[model samples]
Target: MDDQRVSILERIGLEKPLVQAGMGGVSRHLLAAAVSEAGGLGTIAVPGAAAIASELAAARSMTSKPVAVNLLLPFARRSWFEAAAAADVVVTFWGTPKRRVPGIWLHQCGSVDEAHAARAAGADGVIVQGVEAGGHVRGTEPALELLERVKAALPDYPMFLAGGIATRTDVENAVASGADAAVAGTRFLLSDECVAHPEYKQRLLSANSTILTELFGFGWPAPHRVVANEATASQAGPSGEIPFINKLINRASAAGARFTPESVQRRAVAHQSPTSRMLTPHAPSEDLPRRFVEAGPLYAGETVARIDKLLSAEKIVTSLVG
Candidate 1:
């Protein structure tokens, strides 16, 4: 193994080549801190400009180990990146890759081409995301295949594997396929430390399948994965595609969100249209009502089928590395 490629894990101060994916809203301080304490890189998903500092501070107080932050670039403003400077590393998702954070930065890419773009953009590494990833569908293929292509193109670059990660074998496969670490979101989302709604967890527990759709794309018009729910069922045709009229509306909403003032967005979130009522790019935290959660996107990966039980954040890290 090349020192440059393998040393990325060491550079990140990971005891095990495992990373907890920063599930927005779901992976907060307690969960991120616990994973870091367990000897892996724990990541706090970017909460907001107002909360990033406090969230990182809270995680720092809990664990002396390194903690990272995940940012969805579409909604992240320049201030958000500036506010995230405290994290050991900043992991960004979607949109063009940029070096906003001064420290180590990584971008999640859906394809080999995107990985190339990240490298050219001076990203420290890339998280190769497969379409099977929960929360969002980026890559059109499975995780390993995407990793393979990325590895082939940039064999010496630091890389992390996301999607299709639920077992020890999956972690092993990721490393064997040239990933420096295995990034797991769905597994960690089920951890006791995660603040995901109890009802959301329960819904995912019995979920054996997931569907990729744009039903939840009000503020962000990207394809996402979610368990079957009334929200999806209502919009999906027999083939699971949304109708033309709704697609136009979703596209308009996505465009409008770009120019939509934050205050208006907040009000919209507080009083969402019935179509995406109680939904955000972030997963539903415990405070969301069960009724809304049931009708909203149940973001999860295909690995969800393999996870039938919830574990502590530490135990989850141990189980994946073991």
Candidate 2:
């Protein structure tokens, strides 16, 4: 690895600066440990702290390096505070920060106020996830603009920039724009260590760009970027408001197997506004593409267009440092 990469790792209190962003189901033990073993900060995105202890135990079994875990606020399905206290770092997205935990709280921010609020919430660091990001966007500001504002406000705060980060130039630009480090999702999703399904990875590597769509579940109108596909391109026009979409998704979820074949078979996938890029799942099996017909939407980024191969965590980290 490059010397600069080593320095970045030290600065972030890790062995490498190449910290992998949280990706729900995708950030499994293998991927997280692989990054950590390679000297970067590897994190497990636990919707809550429910399995924090078990996950941590498993992570320890994989590598003794520092590991972080993500706690999702928007989902609100689980609470991981107690379990997270045992981790080296804890990242929070979409939720108000609470008491100071042992691990770093990487609060995801889109607006200036949220940054300050995260600081007040005892977050050790903050990640500015711009609207261009694949999974969920918190702000309308371009990623660079948001990073600048965040740096001006929280000069001392450790700021990790996400959304649309795909290339080596992206990393260098982020550092010039005042970001201490860059967090990548789509790029890492294609790694060999990544547990994403094979077909999903192939589709991303084969495509020129991924779509940012609006297939929202729960009350969260989370924007997901994916590859252009049948579900996304077929959603011809706006189905309804956020509420309407939520209700429909809720009905579909509740109906389970009882849902009408039409609803279950409803092939229209919601694509992000202003773009046709569709989100592709990271499944290991070829059957996943068919399974996703009713399965959840794939959350990815525009940078995925640049992902073309499966590199090891070490190669990915070292290349970024150079």
Best-matching candidate per lDDT: 1
lDDT string for model 1 (1-322, tens) is 5798667777778788889998877788999999999998899985467778889999999999989999887778777888798888899989899789888899999999899999999999999999899997789998898888889889888999999999899999898888988999999999999989998998899999888877777678688888876766676654457767666666777755655677776565555433553344546688766666755678999989889999999999889895
Poorly placed runs, candidate 2 (over 4 Å): 1-12, 48-50, 76-79, 236-290, 293-295
Which whole-number lDDT from 0 to 100 does residue 196 have in model 1?
93
Q: Indicate which candidate wins on TM-score.
A: 1
Pairing residues by index, what is the TM-score of model 1? 0.95
lDDT of 2 by residue, 97-157 (tens): 6654664567878888998998787766678877677766676767888988888987767
lDDT on C-alpha atoms for all candidate structures? 0.83, 0.65
Model 1: residues >4 Å from true position, as ranges? 256-263, 272-280
| Residue 281, candidate 2: C-alpha displacement in angstroms | 11
